[model samples]
Target: MNVNIITIDGPSGSGKGTLAARLAAHYQYHLLDSGAIYRLLGLSLSEHGLLEQLNDDIAKCVAIAEQLPIVFKSTEQGVVVLLNGIDVSAKIRTEEVGEYASKVAAIPELREAVLQRQRDFAQAPGLIADGRDMATIVFPEAQVKIYLTASAESRAARRVKQLQGMGLDVRISDILANIQARDKRDMERTVAPLKPAEDAYFIDSSDIGIDEVFNLMTSHIDAKLANN
Candidate 1:
C-alpha cells in the first residue's frame, strides 16, 4: 500500500487541529501542524532590529523560514513548541503573533522557502497535515483531502472559550471582529489564498462531535484506500 497523505484544511478555530491530531493518532501517522510553523516564524521576527524594504524583505523572510529551528516536545501536558531553545508555545499563541503569522504566511518568498519543507513531512507511516493551505497548496495530491469549516460566530465563540480556559480575559465581540478580519485577509491574499481544493470533501463541524468527524474521515480514508 502507498503511504497515505492526509490533508485537513480549514480556517482558524474550525477544530481542524484537534481533528487532525486525533486522525494522526488513530493511524499512527506523522502529524504536521503547518500553521504552527508560520506562527513560530512570526514570533521569531517580532522584535526585529530593522525592517527590510519590501524588495529585500522577502529574501530576509525566506532566509529566516529556511533556517527556522523548531522543535516539538511531546510532554505529558501536550506538545511544547520550542524555537532556538526557548519554550515559545504560549508566547506564540497570542493574537499579536497570530496576526504577524498571517502577514508572513502571505509572503510569496517565505511560502516558497518553506513549502518543500512542509511536504517533506509525508513519509512511510503516513501523514496528516493541518493548515489553511494544506489541501489547496502544500499537498494538492493528498490522497484524503478535507476542508472543515464552522460559522464565523461559532469559531469566535470557540476561541473565546479556549482563551478563557487558558485563564485569559477576552471579549467575544473582539474575537468575532478579528475572525472576520482574518477571514477577509486570508481569502483575499494573492499567494495561496485560502480555499477548498476541487476534490476536497467539505465538512461542517459546528454542531458535530470530534469523534463523529474522526469516524467519518477514517471511514472515507478506508474507502479511498480500498479503491486505490
Candidate 2:
C-alpha cells in the first residue's frame, strides 16, 4: 500500500497540531501547518502598523497570503513560525492575533491564495496537514482525514494553561467565552465555515493524553492503508 496523505482538521486547541507533527515524524512526511498562514497574515499586517485597517484593506490581506514568506523553524520545544524574516512565534500566539487570524481566514480571496500552497507540500512519502479546513477544502481527497475535536470547556481550559505556561496571565472565563464565540463565528461564517468534512473520521480528545491521541490516529491510518 502506498497511501501518503493524512489530514487532521479541527478547531483550535483540539490537539490536532501536536498530533499532526507526531504523525509527520512517524511517517517521515512533510508537514503543512495551515493555521500558520493566517497567523502570518496577521503578523505581516501588524508589522506594517496597519493591523487596525485590515478590515478596510481586505485585498491587501489576500495579497499577503498570496505571497507569504512564512516558514517553520524547528526549535527544542516545537515548531516556531517565522514571518518575513522575523521569528514571530511569540507575537502570533496572543489572543489578539488569533482573533485577527480568524477574521482574515474568513476572506474568500485569502483562502484561495493559500489553498495551493498547502497542497504543494504533499510529497511521495506522506503529508500530515493540520488546520481547520484541511479535510474539507484543502485536501478533500486525502486518504485519511481525522477531525480531532474536544468539548468547548476542555479546549478553553487547555488554551488557558498553554498561555500561562508562556508566562501570560489570562482569565479562564474569558478564554471560555472567546472559544465559544469563535466556534459560533467559524461555523456561521459565509465562507468555508468550520465543520467536519462529510467523510472525515472524528475523534474527541477531551480527556486523552496527546500521545494516546496520536496512537488512535495512527491506528486509523494503518487501517486506512490496509483499505487502500
Candidate 3:
C-alpha cells in the first residue's frame, strides 16, 4: 500500500521539527524526527564511551545503529523517546548531543544503517518526516516535499530564546557560530548533503511566524493530497 508522506527538510533551529510535529497532528500521521534518531545514536555512543572514536571506529557506530534499542511513545506533551527502556527524551536534546549527531550523520555508513529504520515509520495513515535529508533522501517519494529554512542569524536568535526558556544560559554569538558551522558541514558533506529536492516547495521562515509557515506548508500539502 502506498502511504502519503510529507517531508520537511532544513537546517537546525529552522523550526522544521516544530512544524513537522504540528503537521503530523493535523494529519494524524506518524511523526519521524530523523535528527532525533541520530541524536539517540550519538547519545548511545557517548554512553558506550565510543563518541571520541567516531572517526577511528566507524564500524562500531554502524553496528550500534543496526541494533538501536530505542522506542518512541506519543504523549499529549509530545513524543517521549526511550533508549534501552530508559527515558532519554530530554537527554538527547542537548547542544552537545546535537553536535555529536551532526558528526555521526556525516558518516555515510551510519546513515545507511539507520535508513531502513526511518522508512519503517511510514504507516497506513501516513507520515511526516523532519530532517536535513528528508526530502532529498529518506522520503524522496513523499507526496509533499518542503524545504523550510531561515537566515542563520534568525535561527540563532530563535535558538537562544529556546535555550534560555529551558533555563540554560546561552550566548547568541556562540550559538550563531555553531549554527553556521553545522550548516557548512551539512551542506558540504559528500554523502546525502543537505539540499532542497528539485520538486520541493521552499519556505524561508526568517521573516515569518510559525503559524504563517504552517499555513504555507499545509496549503501545499492540501493541494498535493487533493491531486493525489
lDDT of 2 by residue, 1-228 (tens): 343888998888888878888788788788888887787786677777656776687787667778889788766687888777888887887788888778778777777888888888888778899999888888888999999999999999999999999888999999999888888888888887899998888999999888888888889999998888
After superposition, which runs of candidate 2 have C-alpha atoms over 4 Å from their true positions? 1-3, 49-55
Pairs with steric clashes in candidate 1: none
lDDT for each residue of candidate 1 in 152-205, tens digit (9 for 90 to 100) = 999998999999999999999999998898888888999999999999888898
lDDT per residue as tens, model 3, 50-102: 88888788888789999999898889998899999999998888889999999
Ranking by TM-score: 3, 1, 2
Score every model by TM-score: 0.93, 0.93, 0.97
Model 2 TM-score relative to the real fold:
0.93
lDDT of 1 at 170: 97
Candidate 1's C-alpha runs over 4 A off are 49-56
Score candidate 1 by lDDT: 0.84
Q: Weakest 10 consecutive residues, lDDT, candidate 2?
A: 46-55
Name the candidate that leads on TM-score. Answer: 3
